[model samples]
Target chain A: MNIKVAFLAILLMALITYIPRVLPLAIFRKEIKSKYIKSFLQYVPYAVLGSLTFPDILYSTGALTTAVCGTVVALILAYFEKGLVIVALGAIITVYAAGFIL
Target chain B: MKKNFLYGLKRGIPIALGYIPVSFTFGLMAVTGGMPVWMAIFISMSNLTSAGQFAGTYLILHGAGLLEITMTTFVINIRYMLMSLSLTQKLSQDMTLPRRMLIAFGVTDETFTVASMEHGSLSFFYLLGLITGPFIGWSVGTALGAFICSSLPEALSNAMGIALYGMFIAIIIPPAKKSMPVIFIIVISVLVVCILRYIPLFSSISSGFRVIISTIIGAGLGALLFPFEARDNNIQEMRE
Candidate 1:
C-alpha cells in the first residue's frame, strides 16, 4: 500500500469525521432549543439506522436480513432485561445462521 | 481514566468488528485504486470515517479538485456535529479538553450509540471497548483485505463482499421496530434519497454530491416535518 496515500486518507477521514462532531457543538451550543432542531436530533438515530438498514439488507449480503432476524430475536429476549452481552451473542448467532442459511 | 479506556474498548469492539470489513474494503480499494497499503492503513488509523476515505480515495484516483474533495467530505461527515454535542453532556465533568478531543476522535455511530446508553459515571472501559474493537478491526481488516485482494481471485471476493451491507442492515432494523418515529424518518430519508438519485438533473452528479444533497435534504426535511418535542421532553425529564 502507498504509505503516503493511506496517511492522506486517514488524515482526511479524521478531518471529515471530526467536523460532524465538532462543528455543531461549536456553532449551536445551547441554541439548539428550537423544537424542530431538537426533534431532528431526537429522531436522528432512527433515521440513520433506517436509511442504513433496508436497501443494504435487501441488496447487500442478506446478512442484514439475518441480522434483523437476530435483532428481532434479541428484542424479544431483551424484555427480560438480559445483559447486552447475551443479546449481542444472540445476534451473532443469528448472523452466522442467517448468512449460512439465507 | 484507565477504566474509561477499558470500557471504551469493550463497547468499541463490536463496533470495531463492524468497521473492520468496511475499512478493509477501503484499504483494498485504496491499493487497487493505486494507493499504497501502509498509506491506506495510516488513513484508516487517522481518518476513521469510512465514507470520507472512500470519497477521498475516489476523488484522488480520478484527479478531482481539492476544493471539491474538502467540500464533499465536509458534507458527508456533518452529522458528527450532533453526535459530539450530545457526547459532551455524557462525558464526565472531570474530562479535560485534551482528553475530550482525543476521545472525540473515536465518536462513531456504534460508539456513540453504546455511549448514549450509559446511565452515569461514564465507563472508560466501555469507551475503550467501543474504540479498540472497531479500531483494531478496521485496521487489521484493512491490512488483511489489501493483502487478500491483491493475492486472491476476484470473483469469490466479489460474491462474499456483500457482508458489509448486512452489518449495516443489522444496525438499522432492530431499533426501528421499537420506534415508529425513527422508522418514519428512515423511510422518508430513503424515499427522498431514491428520488433525488434518479432525477435527471441529479443523476449526473457523483456519489459524493448525491450523498451531500440527499442526506442534508432528507435530514432537513425530517427535522422540519417531524416535531421531536415529546422525545426531547422525555430524555430531559428522565435525566432530571
Candidate 2:
C-alpha cells in the first residue's frame, strides 16, 4: 500500500470528519437554544435508524422470503422492547433455520 | 477502598458482548481487504469506530490515500460531535471543559443516543461503564476476526451480517409504525440512497462521500420536512 497515499487519505478524511462532528459540539455547547436544532437532534437518531432499516430487507443476499421472515421476527421482538441480545439471537436463529429450509 | 477495575468490567460487559461480533466482522472485512492482523487491531483500538474502521480498511485495500480515509471517516462521524455538544448540555452542567474534551472521543452514535435521553446530570463514571464495554469488545473482536475469520465459513458470515441490518430494523419499525413522518423519512432516505447509487452521476462520488452526503440530505430533509419528535425523555432515560 502507498503509505503517503494512505497518510493523506487519513488526514483529509479526519479533517472532513472532524468538522461536522466538532461543529455541532461547538455550536451546541450552549444550550441548544434554537428549537429547530433541539428538534433536529431529537429525531435525527431515529430518522437515521429508520433510514437504515427500510431497505434492510433488500440489503440481504439470501432468498427474500427467508430474509424477510427473519426481519419480521426481529421487528416483532423489538416491538416488545426486548434488549439487543434477545433481538439478535432471535433473528440469527430464524435466519439460520430459514437458511436450512430454503 | 481503592476504585476497582472490576466495576468497569461489570458495566462494560453488555457493550463488550455487542462488540464481539461487530468487531469480528470489522476484522474479517479488514483481512478480506488485505490488511495485516496487527494493522487491523491497531485501527480498531485507535479509532474505536466500527464503520470508520471498515471504510478505512476498504479504502486502504482499494489503494486509496490517507487524505481520503481521514476525510471520509471524519465526515461520517461528524454526527458524534453534535452528540457531544448536545450531551454537554445534559451533562452535569458543571463538568470541566477538559473532561468534556477528553471524553468526547468516546462520544459514539450509540452512546449519544443512549445518553441524550436520560434525565439529570451526565457522569463520567457511567460513561466509563458504557465506553469500556465496547472498547475491550472491539479490540478483542478485531483480533479475533484477524485470526478466526478464515476458519469461519462465508455462509455464517453472511448470516451474521443479518444482525447489523436487523438491529437497524429493530430500532426503526417500532417508532415508524406509530408515526407517519418517520415512515416518510425512512422511505425518502432509502429511496435517495438507492437513486444515488443507481443514477449515473451520484454513483461517481466516493463511497464515503456517498454516505456522508446521503445522511446530510436525508437527515436535513427529514428535519425540514417531517420534524418528528417524541417526549422520549422517559424512554431514553431508562437506557442510561
Could you estimate the TM-score for every candidate? Answer: 0.62, 0.66
Q: Candidate 1's C-alpha lDDT?
A: 0.56
Alpha carbon lDDT of residue A73, candidate 1? Answer: 56
B91-162, model 1: which lDDT tens digit per residue?
Answer: 555665555666677776666667877788554445555666777787898888677667755443333333
lDDT of 1 at B68: 55
Question: Each candidate: fraction of true contacts kept?
Answer: 0.33, 0.41
lDDT of 1 at B44: 71
The DockQ scores of all candidates, in the order shown, are 0.22, 0.34
C-alpha lDDT of all candidate models, in order: 0.56, 0.60
Cα lDDT for residue A92, candidate 1:
47
